[model samples]
Target: MGSDSKQVSKIPKIDLSGLHPSVAGGERWEAAKAEVAAALFSHGCFEAYFPSSSDELREAMFGSALPEMFALPLETKRRLKSDDVYHGYIGQIPHMAYESIAFDDPVSPTAVEEFTKLMWPEGNSSFCKTVEAFAKALHELVEIVQMMIVESLGVEKHYDSLVSSTTYAVRLSEYGVPLNQDTKIALDPHKDPNLVTVVCQSKIDGLEVQTFDGDWVNVDPSPNSLTVMVGQAFQAWSNMRVRAPYHRVRVLGKEKRFSAIFFSRPSHNSMVKSPEELGDEDHPLLFKPFSYTEFVKFLYSEEGRKAKNPFNAYFRIGNEEAA
Candidate 1:
């Protein structure tokens, strides 16, 4: 569905440059917190802008490296394939027109090294190095965004600890039209299974978010900004105070679309539950505590695919079956 430019124009834009001083409770911090809170509660999504220097670094790496890697032949790309959903190349599937390669926790040197070998067995160290640098830069930006999200929810105390040990998975996706002109869903509608998802879309627009009233509105691509969507983990952590908006992608026209999506999540063993500060008798823990691993398994399970909100299925208030 084509997005009404007017509707897309109204999506909130959040500048994260001032998030640091705000964390220490600066003047700018209050305004930033209010902006973020309003955006999350009202729209469940917002466009985020980092400092110009950081944006330049991200654009240089993702803007170039992703296109080059996707341009590789099918067989060459398949060399990095794996059955694991968290890692390796996922070739184009039935409803989706995109092919993606996922790298786990790009900030880790060991993880980066292993991923580089798998992606370029023939020894393209330069490409690997470039990706590592990009990952490092992106990770820094993610930390800032995570803090903003946590602080916006009025849980500023947990910001540092929550983000410090979190794991980030980066996926580079390439979306294109089918040769047969068959109607295929570019990306299906689903809520992310992480705390938050930060996506930098290349200048074509195809992303859409489902509004509270059940209408889908297009998230048009904007220059030098990343579209941030709240994920299931955040919903659970906020005890449903924050929503995980369902979103999808569509092919707009002749051009192929590319995006660098970073999924931010807690450590595998970290227990995800609503912050006690956010709960009371009125909203006594809406979700049961669960680990990231349990959550991931549910996301890939049959029940998860069928459930409208997997978080609810797994931890909602007393469905006898879930209990």
Candidate 2:
């Protein structure tokens, strides 16, 4: 019964076996065990470690390429402003949530200022290579997890085939000041509005996740391991059997921490839903069907409407196809 508490101090890890085969190396196997069924109603978090030997390659792929990609001058980054493609780059996005907390409620003025002055700086050739490699490695890991979920549902021999046409985006973020926050650096508390987030970090810590009891749990970085959690779509598909947890970052201490996050998203045009085993008449559909592009646009809109956050709106529950 090795648990998440046994592994790291402040970080919480949802052991996958809680959702898969609970009996380790046991021969008694059902289509999907009872524990797996119950886990669908509980937390969907897990921890994984990559060997240090692979760290160099992972960093080169995910860590390095990000700044290199973002540093191509304002004009160059703007040129890649992920228009309808929804797959390229977002030059400079304003920090809409926490800005108001520090200044006012409609928080985009000074927030945008800080983001412009700070945030991602320049991209380097060597860094881009490392970040890209890490992204690819993490992508493979997500695919593996998806396949297992498909099997657990007792359907779709190849789960990936269902999501083959999807486009997945990964972001490598560096937050706070370089060991100095009183000067010019700060990030707000906001949950990622995506399907799943796999995060890997350096020595510095800043991540916190909400647990079932409505308490914040800190996620510290392991030397070579990445932390993975379920997102909104997965929750919707399961009719909320799987819930998307809330998370935020707090600027602690003063060491500049580098984190590589691979954001796994459905294709802009794909519709997400749960397996027959997980959905029912009661849970029905809970969200409207919309393209990832539309979802993002709505999220960034000034209308100030509260729709489903990225992490809570997956496998929609409405007849959006007719609309």
Candidate 3:
């Protein structure tokens, strides 16, 4: 339950076999259900190992050209500016704007190449085909995991129905050097704005998560593996049963760190209503139906600017205005 150096192993691996209702009723279903329940109730996070091929496809996303792309001078990267959508290169978003989500002193862009702005990298049509295929691959996997989560909760229907088409985003985060400051400059503690984030970190280790008993655990990058995190939207739909874990990227050492985060979110107008069975007197109607676009703008505003944890703002746990 806690992440002491000795107890890090206690973090349970997500049981993928339970992707269907029957999976939870089998001999080991109870154990699987308990594991997921504990993860939801405790740390608000869990790790599921994707196949090696998945990792390979993800690696392909960060093509040989990506390095050069991210390596592009900041001036060039700015050319692909995203207006309201923070899709393009983010220069140096202040700590306050993303305080609830990113903990670094000042969130700065590490790298952005010519191709980083596209949904998928550009090359020949063959490469475009592969990119589309890759997106489907990842989407199917997320669906499987989502169903299992629904089954585990003993809900009447799969949670997928509540979601429309999912919106997936991939970002190549380059945490550049501290710019001569004596103190270490890196991202701060925060939760993601999407539904679920599947992060593929480079060899460099700096990502950390808060444990149930209040200890920081380093979530290292494994060869061809993903670090899965639940996000604000998912937590909102789950009605506080599942939580969005608090995490941050700390750029240790002097070298720049490259991390590729594959963000999976539901469509903008998708409604996040309370699960039928989960609606009770205690839980009640905690969240009104909100579009992800609106949530994004809200997050861009003051309510989203106060804390290092996005879940705090999204869930209105402590903010009186949101309440």
Candidate 4:
């Protein structure tokens, strides 16, 4: 709730309990959609109060399942491998305490089962069930958030295809930190390149998002709420109408931090493009249509990191002569 800059406005909070179609009236849904659009454009992130994220669900994930998974031998955890970036086990770096494993299509039962079985070769049905249930619940929130973004942008016509063309991934991370008095920066500041990133953090205050005014704000979310963030691909898809906040995790308190991050991105073969109407006089074509897969390649490449404006440098519509 408190940001470094006292002048910075608090991050917007949206109630998404109106998940059931008939439960929420047309007017209320529309208002929520508008709020989502405004928040993304303004802060590039918001805290969502989703009542469905019960305490039991949170405990199953943060309390036991994740802890046990991380407790596995390093070799056992590394068994879940992948060729894709950040999709497999990543940790045990020289000095960093961060460790993570991501599962694609986490909403599907298969992905969850595969990961669980890999860690527990013989069998571990409980972990599989908990992960599947948690991811499925989170997926519902992601779907509606994406829908709200598209609808608020006046591109509701493309919503169906957009949904179909998306692939989801969930990354679970745990940070190892000593109980030192000094604050430690666990991760550097960076914006996600996907469409949207929704994160559920264990009850530790660490995640921070930068405000438009160049100030960082702590995202202290409630147990029943998930913090949703806009990402670069969505910024481009919305013709730069939505901004992605640069965020990082800091170990303010002397405690290890754990987080579950859910990402919804375009399928590997799908393209990321904004509606022609989005490129009006005020917002001339800032970026061109580019492949999400290729962009991701550049995102993790040396050139991408060196470039000050990676997305624009990679696919901007104008400035052919600048190069």
Question: By TM-score, is 1 or 3 better?
Answer: 1
- Model 2, residue 125: distance off in Å is 5.4
On residues 34-122, what C-alpha lDDT tens digit does candidate 2 reach at each position?
Answer: 33334434546655544531656655533554435444466644433334433334323454111110111011233323333333444
Question: Least lDDT summed over 10 consecutive residues: which range in candidate 4?
Answer: 1-10
**What C-alpha lDDT does candidate 3 achieve relative to the native structure?**
0.57
Q: TM-score: which is higher, 3 or 4?
A: 4
RMSD of each: 3.7, 10.0, 6.8, 3.4
Pick the lDDT winner: 4
| Most accurate candidate by TM-score | 4
TM-score of each predicted structure versus truth: 0.85, 0.65, 0.73, 0.91
- For model 1 the TM-score comes to 0.85
lDDT of each: 0.72, 0.49, 0.57, 0.81
lDDT of 4 by residue, 1-323 (tens): 33543233378998887575334338778888888888888889999998777889888888888998999999998888776766799987766678998879888888788888899988898788888888888888888888888877888788877778899999999987733324466776788989999999999867888888778878885779899998888888887778888888877665777888888999986888788878888778676678888888887889888877676667753542211
lDDT of 1 at 13: 90
Worst 10 residues of 1 by lDDT: 1-10
